[model samples]
Each structure stands twice: as C-alpha cells, then as structure tokens.
Target chain A: MEGPKIYGELFGLPITQTLVNTWIIMAMILVVCAILTKNMQKRPGKAQVIAETIVTVMDGLVGQTMGKDKMKFAPWMLALIMFLAFANTSGIYGLRSPTADLNCTVGLALMTFFMTQFYGLKSKGLGGFLKGFLEPMPFLLPINIIGEFANPVSLSFRLFGNMLGGGIIMALLYSALAGLYFFPVLIPVPFHFYFDIFSGLLQSFIFTMLSMVFISGAMD
Target chain B: MEGLDFIKACSAIGAGIAMIAGVGPGIGQGFAAGKGAEAVGRQPEAQSDIVRTMLLGAAVAETTGIYGLIVALILLFANPFY
Candidate 1:
C-alpha cells in the first residue's frame, strides 16, 4: 500500500506489482521454453543444462513426496518452485519477490486449495469426496468444513510473512548501515539464504506436496 | 492518557491479529509432517528423500507463520496503520 497503488476496474480487483510480476514470470517461462525447445540440445548447452537440472531436481523431489503413481504432478511442482525461487531471490538484485505481497501469496494458496479440493474430488469421486469430510467423525463434519475453508488463510500467510519479514529487515538493516557495506551484506547473507532461498524453495515444495497430498487424501 | 491508552489497545489488537496468521501455517505444516511420516513408513529406503522433501515442504509451510509474525512486528514497530 505504501509502495504501490492498487486500483479496481471493471473486474473489480486491485492490481498490484505482484500481479504484474506473476505475468512477467509466466511470459519469461514461455519464452524460455520456446527458445530451449527451438534448439533441441542433446549434448546440452548452459541454458539446457540448467533447465534439465531444475526439472530433474524437482522431479526427484516430487517422486519422494508424492510417489511414482503421481509423478505427473512433477511439472507443476517444478514450475512453481522455479518461479518462486527466482522470484524470492529477485530481491538480491534490487527487485521484490511476488510472495512479498499478501494478495499474491494468498492467490497462490487459494489456487492450491482449490486444486486440492477439485483433485481430491476427482481422484476419490463425488461419494468419496463427501465421505472424506466425515473422516474420524460424523459429528465433526461442520468443523471439517471450516478447516477446509482455512487452508488458504494458512498457506498464503506462511509465504507472505516470511518474504515480507525478510524484506523489511533487509530494508531496515541496509538503511541503518548506509555508511557501511560489510556488516549489512555479511550479516544479512544468512537471512537472505534462509528467507529467500531456503524458505522460498521449502514453501514451494510444501505447497506442491500438500496439493498432492490433499488430492490423494481426498480421493482415498 | 486516553489517546495513549487507545493507541496501546490498537497495537495490542493488531499484534493479536498478526499472531492469528500462525494458525494457518500450523495446520498446513502439520499436514506436511504427517505425509512425510506416512511416506517414510511406506518406503524406508527413501527415508532420506522423504525427509528432504518433508523438511522442504514443512519449511515452505512455515512461511505464512513468519508472515503473521512480520505483520505483528510491523504493528509493534512499523505500524503504517497507526
């Protein structure tokens, strides 16, 4: 709010920098795919190697999290992770992470929650889906419904908090040490790693894995 | 005295709201943890992988909680709302 102005249009939505950045990431991914696939490299160039590595790493992660039966979800997980990892570290070069915004993070969380519900229903079927709501108690259905509604609240805030925290701290720290460079960078290095790299990647993985779990659990 | 007291009350309310953010991540991270345990039970050979993935997911799951803390801190130290 202090940084960017949010305006509502015919769509009746507040468009912020995070939304713009989401589009930027999507466009970049598409462009990268076109370029990478345009020159099919078997031996591998720098870009190709990096792409492969990212995919392979995420694929391995999905395999571990969701099992071989659900390996198809790997691509989705990889894309989300790569986007988040890049976006989180965007601040390293004087940019902000989209996850730094409540709307952006909440939007993603809602998407995950929706996917969780939809796929859970899809895999488990309608009857199974309804049945899942009654798990461990027929009397707890109302509470479970409330729990389902709360998924996005939790998911969105988790990401938003960490990114915003890191951002605010870095800003405060950097300003406090305007005259000096060493301590600001050195001291905050761990912070950037933990908040941006570690937390960013971890959150992405968690989001993807949970989505899968929700689907499986719903269907089961 | 009334004005100062009111400000203090508002800040306290904001802090409480911020802490409420922790609730969401708590449930989410717990879900991730349970899944990780289940995964390990199924495939002990993949225990390392399971742990790595679970820890990774749990860490992500923990972000929202951090966010709530940030908001609470902002309320305390950098309350734009005030």
Candidate 2:
C-alpha cells in the first residue's frame, strides 16, 4: 500500500518523519518521567498533583478490574496507558503518530502477549497452564492454541488500524481546511474532539483493559 | 490490454480491502460496550464512571478502524500511483 513516503535516508535506513517524531516524543516522555519522579512531595505540588491523579485513577481501575491480587500490574498498565495516550494524541501536532507504525503497535502487543503468558505461568504452573487450553473440550486443544496465538495479532492490528485511521482523517481534514477555512466551525471541531482527543485516550484504555482481561483469563 | 483500467479497478478493490481492517475494532469495541452494559446493569450507582471508562476503552478500539478508513479514502481520492 502506498502510504507516507520516506523523506530521506540516514545511514542507509529510511527515516520517515514519523520515526523522528517518535524519538522526539520518547525524549519528552523520559524527561517528564524523570522530572515527575524526582520531585516528591508530602503536602502536594501542582506537578505531583497531576501525576498522583493519573496514578490514582489508573490504580483504582486496575484494582476494580483485576482484583486486589493483581495490583502489581497496575504500574505497568499505567505506564502503557500514559505512553499510548501520548503517542496517539501526538497526532494533534503536525507530527506523525508512532501508533501509525505497525512496528510500534506490534511491539506493544507482543509485550502484552508475553505479560499475559508470564502472569499465567506464574499464577498457574506449567501443567495448569496447559490444562487451561483443554477447558470445555479436551478435543479443542489445537483450536484453543491457535486462538491464543491469534490474540496479539488481533490486538496489535486493532490499535494500529484505529490510530492510522484517525491520523489519515486528520491529515485530510487539515488539507480540506487549507483550501476552505470558512467551513462550519461545528463540523470540524467536533470531529477533532471525537477523533483525536477522545479516541486517542479511549484506545489506550481499551488496549490496557483488554490486555488485563486476557492475562486474567489465562491465569484463571 | 487496458492496464490502467485494471490498476484503477485493483485500487478500488484495494480500498475495500483496507476497510476490512475495521472488523478488529468493531468486535473489540462491541466487547467493551457489552462489558460496560453489564457493569452498569449490576451497579447502577456507578453508571457514570463505568460508562466513562467504557467509552475510553472503546475509543482506543476505534483507532484501527479509523486507519482502515483513511487507507480506503486515500486509495479513492489520493492514490499515489495515480
């Protein structure tokens, strides 16, 4: 498929604008994380407040969904949600979202797949893990294995497709706006509101929640 | 031997093929929605928060679907090969 073209080559590697923007975003996340973590406060500072709110919300979410036993996974889930939320919302700027790249999405999905497997193996020993597949029907072992194999493929593609769609629409919308700025404000604003802001955060949450669901299901 | 016509038809077909990616989010979001409904039904008091979380998750699920649409649209209107 003819998608965004590489602008140039750096050391034989085709570096697209998306790749550069991802580095920029990565740098920003690292800086922010460092700053936020370094500044610890008991009374409460504004930055700490913001960070605490995010952690509190996500922690509550993990506790509610996965039960108290899985609270350890909360921090990982929080990091995933924040990283993805930022990655998806990066489209608001002129930069290409990293989520648009299959590499990024697939990598994230692979991590989730591994985490699910890891947690499953931890909660249930190797024999118990194998027994999970044989549930409901011992005859369906092969099919169940195939279904487990397909999880990451499906999960990765789901996020990739959605982010790519929003980015493309936003691109087209901006192009449309360039030619016709006088287009009804309501029409464009709501579209941006829903597609970029809402969809970005929503997708990240879904990714985390579904990852949790799969892991919990496996362990159970 | 109308090669150009074949390419155009192929792209049109390709556009449709791209949209097929929409199935991923459709099923994913539907699951989120059903879970949200179930959560709300069980605990009506937490309806607002449940709905909020559900929508957030559904929004993430919606992204890939949007990507497929973008590909389809590009194929239709901004075909690079053209």
Candidate 3:
C-alpha cells in the first residue's frame, strides 16, 4: 500500500514514521525492563518474577540451541528476541512495525553476520577461519565465500518479506471491508491473529534461533 | 503513454509469474510435516522437540517462497516499469 510517512527532515535526513515507532518501542521496552528489575530481592516479587522468568527462559533457549558454554550470548539474544517480538506485533497497536522497513531488518541481519564472522575468527584463529573456506575441497572455496555473503541477504529478506507481506495483506483486507458495517471490525480479527500475533511471534523466534545457531556454529 | 501501458501490463504478468516459486515450498513443507507427524507418532515424549525442529526447518525451506513474495510485492507496489 503506502510507504511509511515521512514526518520531516532532521538535518539532511528525513525522519520517518518507522523511526518514530522504533524509538517508541525501544523506550517502552526500556521502561518495562527497568520496572521489572527494580531493587534487589532474595525472594522475588511479581515484577522480579517476570524478569527472572524471561531471563531463565532465554538462558534455557540459548543453552539448548547453542550449548551451555555459549551462555554468554543469552543476554544479547534475549534483547534481540524482545525487540523483534515487539516490532513485529506493533501492527496490533496501529503502529507500523519497524521491522517492515528493509533498513531495520538488514541492519539486524548484518549484526548477526558480523557476530558470526567475528566469533568464527575468534575461536578458530585467522588461519583456521580461512581454512574453513577451503574445506571438503579447495575448489569449493568460491562457493563457500559466496555462501557466507548470502547469509545476511537471505536473513534480512526473510524477515523483511514476511513482515511486509503480512502488512500488505492486512492493509488490503481492511480497505476491502471498510465500507461494510461490522464487516471491517469482525473479519480482520482472524487475519490480525495470524499475521500480527502468531506469525509475528513465530518469525521472531525463528530469527533469534537462527542467530543463535549461526553464531554458535561459527564458534564451534 | 501507449508503451508505458504495455510495460505495466507486462509487469503485472511478471508479478504473477514470480509467485510460481510458492509451489516448491508448499510441497516441501507438506512433505516435511508428514515426516514430522510420523516422528511424533513414533515418540510421543519428544513431540515438543520434533515440532520445534520441524518448524525451524520448514521456515528455512520457506525462504524461497518469501523471495518470490518480495519480488511480486516490489513489482506491485514499487514497480520500476513506470
């Protein structure tokens, strides 16, 4: 349908609705996390319980997917999943999802790409990392190199396309029912359920899980 | 203007054609789901793990379909033919 609204120019750059929504989401998450984690407690209260559950679940996920030794990545992976879940579901609140923007998804995917490479190098050393490219056969080096570059492109497009597709479908559905009484209100709930809630959460999980797999795969 | 109209018509057809890529993932996912179901039937205790692994693999398989969708969307909303 329509592109994200350009609110105004900041310096030479245009400030868009996507950026505003992203900032709002960031602040909301920050506030919620701060409130949940307030004060030290040996016996956890309700808020602390929520915080502890989130941390424990994330740690468990990282441990299961990436192994116990890679528990160091749990916090980063938790932050990623939380941001993605919120961004993908922002459509529910009538805010355009920041993840629908190509720039946002690409930036995230690039972070994964860099982490994968950096960790690979760190664990394997420069020689071993290069040797990885030559594995199975030296002739497959170019293919391996291309495969490495393709990872970020595929990861970014996978996320961007899914969110964008869901947004487009929801937009089309809303407009088609706009003139009908009660139809617009009733018909879109299931669509919203699938696209905004179910698909949003699933995609976020997939993205986080893939990142963990990639990063850990590189390290080991 | 006449040539522009022809280009637009061709782009519309191209968008539809791009979506043909969905067929592969549809078939692949169905096959994967069947196997996943079989695995669950064999070991009910590991159903959660089986489903999780199935979903992850299915998502990866769905990437080609997503690429097709992206091309179609670009052609429809952000057409360069104009």
Candidate 4:
C-alpha cells in the first residue's frame, strides 16, 4: 500500500523489498532448473517428464501466438512467463509481489517495447519501419509516434495496476478483519485465491501473450 | 493554513472519485459475457473456445478498472501530499 519499503543501501543503490523478492524468485527458478536438468536419462524420470511438459507447453504457446517461424523466441517467452507467474503470486508467501512495484513493471514493459522496436527494425529495414509511421498519410506521423510510445506506458500500468490493486485489497481486508479473531483466519482465503492465484496467473499469461503479439506484429 | 483533517478529507474524496473508472470495465465485460453466451448458445460444441476467448478479452478490458483501483489505492494508502 505504501510502496515497497527500502530496507537499506548497497554501495550506492537503494535496496527495496521488491528487489529482495525478485532475487529470491530468481534463485528459486535457478535452483528448480538445476535440479530438473542435473541428470539426463534416455528413459525420462518424473522430473524429466515435468520439465518436458513445461517445455512443450511453452513451445506450443509461442508457436500459436507468434507463429511457428518465431519458435526461437520460446525460451525468452518461457522465462518471462515463469518470472511473472512467480512474481505475481509471491503475495501468497507474504512477500510483496515485485510486479506491484511500478519500477519492476516498467522495466519489464520497457524490455517488451525495446524488443518490439528492435525486431521491427531488424525485420523491416530502418527506412521501411520509419515509412510505417507515414502510411495512408504523412500527416499521421505524430499520431503514430504517440501511439507507439503509449504501448510501454499502458503495458506497465496494466500490470502494475492489477498487482498493486490486489495487494491493497488484501492489506485492507486483513486490517479490517483483524478485530475479529476467527474472521482474520478464515475470511481471506477466498480473496487470496482470487487475487493472488487466479488473477496472478491470468495476468502473467496475458502479459506474455501480449508481448508475443506485439513482437510478432512488429516483425510481420 | 489547511489542517491535516482537510488533507484526509480530500484524499478520501479522491479515492472515491478514482473508483468511477470501474464502470467502464463492468459494462464492457458484461457485454462480452452476453456475446459469449450468445455464441455458445448458437454453437454449444465450441463453448470451451468461446469461453476461453471471452475470458482473455475480458481480462484485457479489465485494464482500465485496475488503473482506477490503483489510483484509489494510492490516494488511500500512499497519498503523496500527506
């Protein structure tokens, strides 16, 4: 509600709870990946089966959203989705979701935006990409530029807003119910399910899907 | 000079006003749900696909409402002026 608390400073940079949570998420992901891939077997074990299923699902998602030709983007998409899924659901673990912080969401959105522009330029030459802005009429260039700039802003705010809203509601609910001993224990479960689990996963999926659409749209 | 009470009052009003953005998403999602129901009624076999698409589009449509909630929360808990 009051934004992520700054715990301390490291060197010159301010360290916030969000940063710590992000690092934790990253470490967890790394450890899981390491454990899953530590041993290779011709006849797959349960861990290998789980890992393969995840890979196949991600591959299918990328292929469906960005086209089969863009399967190269599957790894990045998988990483983004996995990070977002964990970040958005970190509230269940009593950690402030990094996505709730404007800085985090903006950074993620900027990555998508830059990727969109970079791939656009790569697929279409600079001249062609520039020419895209002048389509139908050259006078529409300013409008097109504004629309292009709005992408990252809306993308960031959409995610930040949803995550922060959930955090605020959960905080307020806990405070309001604290007076009732049993209510505090029992009432927040459904709210937690909807906000932290359902909305978190759905938002992560939406963000990944939108990123795919934007990048692929640029390339195509 | 305005006292702390005035600031609190204004923050409360601001939070209330910010929540007005929810109206747009409420109507939009309801419209989507109705259309989805119509489609499913017409082709019951494709209900799963229709529901999936409807949910995705509704989630996108929810952006504005979430934006409103953010503004309201900021006003209530993170009032910059305070």
Candidate 5:
C-alpha cells in the first residue's frame, strides 16, 4: 500500500523496513541451516534426513536445469532459491517481503546477471563470448547487447511486480473488509492463501528457475 | 487545485486502462492449460513432467500482465505526474 517505512539513518544512509527484513531473513536462514546440519550421522536422524533431502533435491534440480556437469553450481543456486523463498513468504508473517522491494530484487538480479556474464566468459573465453553478439549478422549486435542487459531488468521487475501486486491486493482487501459490518475473520483467508502462499511460492520458484536458465544459456 | 485533481483523475483512469494487458496473458495461459491437459490425456505417463512444463510456461506468459500491473501501481502509488 505504501513504501517501506524508514526506521532510521546510519552513516547518512536511511535504514528501511526492507533492509531490516532482509537481515532478519538471512539470520533465520543461517539458524535453520545450523539446526538442520548440526549432527553428522551414518544412518540418519530427522534433521539429517531433512538436510540431505534438501541437498539432493537442489542438486538434482541444478543438474536437470543446467547440466549434470554443472553440478558445481548447485550450492549457489540452492542459496538463491532458499533466500528467495523466505523473502517472498515473509509477507505472510506481516513483515514486508523483501522481493517486493525493487532494490532487493534488483540486487538479486544483478548477481544473476554478473554470474551469467562471468561464467559465459569463463567457459567460452573472451573471443567466443564477444562473438556471440554478432551471430545472424553484425547489424544484430546492438540488439543482442540490449537483450543481454534486458535480462536483469526484466528479472528484477518480474519478482518485484508480482510480490508488490500481491501485497497491495492483500492490503486493499483487508482495509475493505475492516470497514464492513461483521468481523472479517474468515473472509480474507482465501485471498491470503492465493496471494501470500500460492503466488509467493510460485514467483520464488520462477525466479530461481529463470536465473538457472540464464546462467546455463550463457555457458552453453 | 483544479490541475492537480485533473491529473489524479486521469491517472486513476489510466491505471484501469493499463490492466487491459491482463487479457493477453489470460487467453495465453488458458490455451497453454488446455493444451497441457490434452497432452496429459494423450500421454498420462508423463503427466508430472507435462504439468510442470505447463506451469512454468504459464508463469512466463503471465509476465506481460505483471508488467501492466507494475505500470498501474506506479500510477496509483508512485505517480510521476503527482
């Protein structure tokens, strides 16, 4: 409904709810990882099983999306997906979802953009990477360059727009129901289910999937 | 006062107009879903893979609608004209 609240200023930079929410989400993720991975077991306990399942699923996803040889990217992709999932779902807890902020989404997208370019050059050498823009004809080089830059713009906007849109709709719905005669308890549940749960989860998955596609595309 | 009110009125209308972009994704996703169902019917064994691909494609197709939403929200909440 409105921009993230500015809490205070530090070193001439204003601290906003988005930044605070991001820090909290990051710390929560670290704590969860520590708890899940605390004990080592040959057979397995519940937490160990959960940790192994997450690792195996992410590794399989990276292999399926990128390639079997690119299994090295599994950790990075897993972190991206995990962070995104938390950021997007934070809305359900009354905290502003960090992905709803353009700055946060842009930062995430920039990481993907740089990784794509870095790995592209790393895998194909400078000459081949540069020559990629000239395919079909030299005249199409500018178009190709624009397309490369557009990836990050679209990626950031896609996540930001979806999360913000859902947040706005939820906010409007709650305010509308609050003005009604009866208690608006159960009325907003379906909306919460669709907007916060369904769309949030789907957008997070789509973001990570698109990132994987872009990085893999550059490499191959 | 009159000019500011006029701009706000126009932006409210423009926000409604921007949402016309939703029609494209609505139709595109419906077609995708229909085709996906047909594919599943033809090859029930690959239903999981087919549905997964369909959902991903539908999400991508929904981007234009999301773009339109961003434009409408900008006009409503972060209006440059304001």
Candidate 6:
C-alpha cells in the first residue's frame, strides 16, 4: 500500500524504515561474515566448513550460469543473493521487507544493469559495444536500445511487485481476520509460508540468476 | 465536491481493471505447467530438473500478475491522486 514510514531525517536526506532495515541486514551480514572467517585452520572447523561450502556452491553456480570465465563475478552475485534473500524474507521477523520499496529494488537492478554494460564494454571495446545495436541490421538499433532499457525496468518491478503484493495480501488478511480470535492465529500460517518464505527465496534466486544471465549475455 | 466522489469511483474501477492483467500470467503458467507435465511424462528420470525449471519460469511469468496486483493495491490503499 503506502511506502515505508519516514522515521526521521539525516541532514538533508529523509531516512525511512526501509533504509534502517537495510542497514540492519547489512550489519548482520557483515558480522556473520567476520565471525565465519575469523579462524582459518588446516583442519576446517564447523564454521569454516559452512563458509567454504557456501563459497564453493556460489562459485559453482556462477560458473554454471555464466561460465568459468565469469567466475570473478561470483562474489557480487553471492552478496546480491544474500542481501535479497534476507530483505525479501524480513517479513518473518515482523519487519517490512525493504525489497517491497521501489527505490531499493530499482537501486539493485540498476547495479546489475550497470555491471552488464560495464562488462560488455570491457569485453568489447566501446566502439564494439556501441556497434552491437547495429548488429544484423542498423534499422534495429532503436528496438535493441529499448530492449536493453527494458531489462532494469522489468527486473526492478518484478522484485518490488512480488514483495509488495505479499505484504499487502498479508496485511489485508490480518485485518480481515482480526475479528475472529482463533482465525487470526490459525489462518495466516500457510499464507505466510507461501508468500513470505517460498516466494521470497524463489524471487531472490530468480533475481540473481537473471542478473547473471543478462551480464553474461551482454559480455558474450 | 462532485468531482472528488467522481474521482474516487473512477479510481476503484481503474483498480479493478488493472487486475485483468492476471489473466496473462494465469494462462502462461498453466501452459508452462502442462508442458512441464508432458516433459516429466516423457522423461520420468528428469522429473526433478523439469519441475525445478518449470517453477522458475512460472515465477517469471508471474511478474505481470504481480504488477497488476501492485497497481490495484496502490489504487486502493495508497492512491497517489488522493
């Protein structure tokens, strides 16, 4: 429904609940990463094993999706998935998912869009990248440009729309069931499972996978 | 004013109309599911992979429906015109 509430302002900028929640997610991620990597041993500890497994899984995923040559992008993809997974599922903790905000989703999608363009330019020289729009026929250049621009729009709206829809439905359900004492307790659990947990993780995976595809497609 | 009531009534109708976009994803995902079933039937061994890919594609197909829901929700709860 409405955007996140504005808690206050910092200097000239308005600080919203979304921003606060995002900062919390970031700090949590930072603390976990630090703790997980604090001790490196010849014989891996449980934490190290978990950390290594995550890394290798992410590495394998990126390799499979974007090819081994694009493995350098694994760290960025990993961070994107981690942030999105947490942000999308924050509703479980009774916090509004930051991904429900257009600004957050758009910002993340723009990062992916920029990465695609940057890698494209690097792989193909500036002239070559520019010339790509003219491929097969120069008449198709405008269509190609529009297609490229559509990527970020669709990407941002896809994530934002899903999370916001979930939030709105959950809110409406709670209010609708507020009159029934037991309905409120019994009804929302399955809805929460489908909307918050399943859709949240699925959307996060889709977003990251699409980012990899777009970036790799551009570079190739 | 009469104008204010008129706008509110129109906004409600607009929200209802926006939800018609759900038709696209419904049809698309149904077709995807049918195809997924066919694939799984053809290769029973690859059921897991087929189902996984189908779910992924179905989620993407759901974007337009979600967009429609968003517009309807915004119109009802966060009308910018208001």
Estimated TM-score for each candidate = 0.74, 0.79, 0.96, 0.94, 0.97, 0.95
List, residue by residue over A9-93, the lDDT tens digit for candidate 1: 4477778677777777778778978776666567988778877777788778677667778777787777776677667766675
List, residue by residue over A1-220, the lDDT tens digit for candidate 4: 6768899999999999999999999998999999998787999998998999999999998998899999999999999999999999998998899999999999999999999999999999999999989987999989999988988888899999989888888988988887774645667899999999999999998899999999998896
Instruction: Give candidates' CA RMSD values in order.
Output: 5.5, 4.3, 1.3, 1.7, 1.2, 1.6
Cα-based lDDT at residue A20, candidate 1: 72
The residue ranges of model 1 lying beyond 4 angstroms of the native Cα positions read: A1-3, A6-15, A31-35, A41-46, A179-187, B2-5, B8-54, B57-71, B77-82
Better of 3 and 5 by DockQ: 3
lDDT of 2 by residue, B60-81 (tens): 5665666677678778977888
Off by over 4 Å in 4: A181-184, B1-4
Report how far residue A69 has shifted in candidate 1, in Å: 3.3
Worst 10 residues of 5 chain A by lDDT: A85-94
Candidate 1 TM-score over all chains jointly: 0.74
Rank by DockQ (best first): 6, 4, 3, 5, 1, 2
lDDT winner between candidates 2 and 4: 4
Tens-place lDDT per residue, model 3, A1-220, is 5788999998999899889999999999999999998995999889999999999989999999999998999989999999999999988999998999999999999999999999999999999999999988999999999999998898899999999999999888878887776644567889999999988998999999889988998887
For candidate 3, the C-alpha RMSD (Å) to the true structure equals: 1.3
How far in Å is the alpha carbon of B15 misplaced in model 5? Answer: 1.3
Model 4's chain A TM-score stands at 0.96
Q: Cα miss at A36, model 2 (Å)?
A: 3.7
- TM-score of chain A, model number 6: 0.95
Error of 4 at A23 (Å): 0.8
Per-residue alpha-carbon lDDT of candidate 6 for residues A1-220, written as tens digits (9 for 90 to 100):
4679998898989999999999999998899999999879999999999999999999999999999998899999999999998899998988899999999999999999999999999999999999999987999999999999999999999999999999988988888888775735667899999999999999999999999999999997
Model 1 gets an lDDT of 0.73
Model 2, residue A58: C-alpha shift (Å): 1.8
Candidate 3: tens digits of C-alpha lDDT, residues B19-68: 99999999999999999999999999999999989998898898999999
Under CAPRI classification, how is model 4 graded?
Answer: high
Separately for all candidates shown, the number of backbone clashes (residues 3 or more apart, or on different chains) is 10, 12, 0, 0, 0, 0
DockQ for each numbered candidate:
0.54, 0.45, 0.86, 0.86, 0.85, 0.89
Q: Residue by residue across A57-80, what tens digits does model 5's lDDT show?
A: 999999999999998889998899
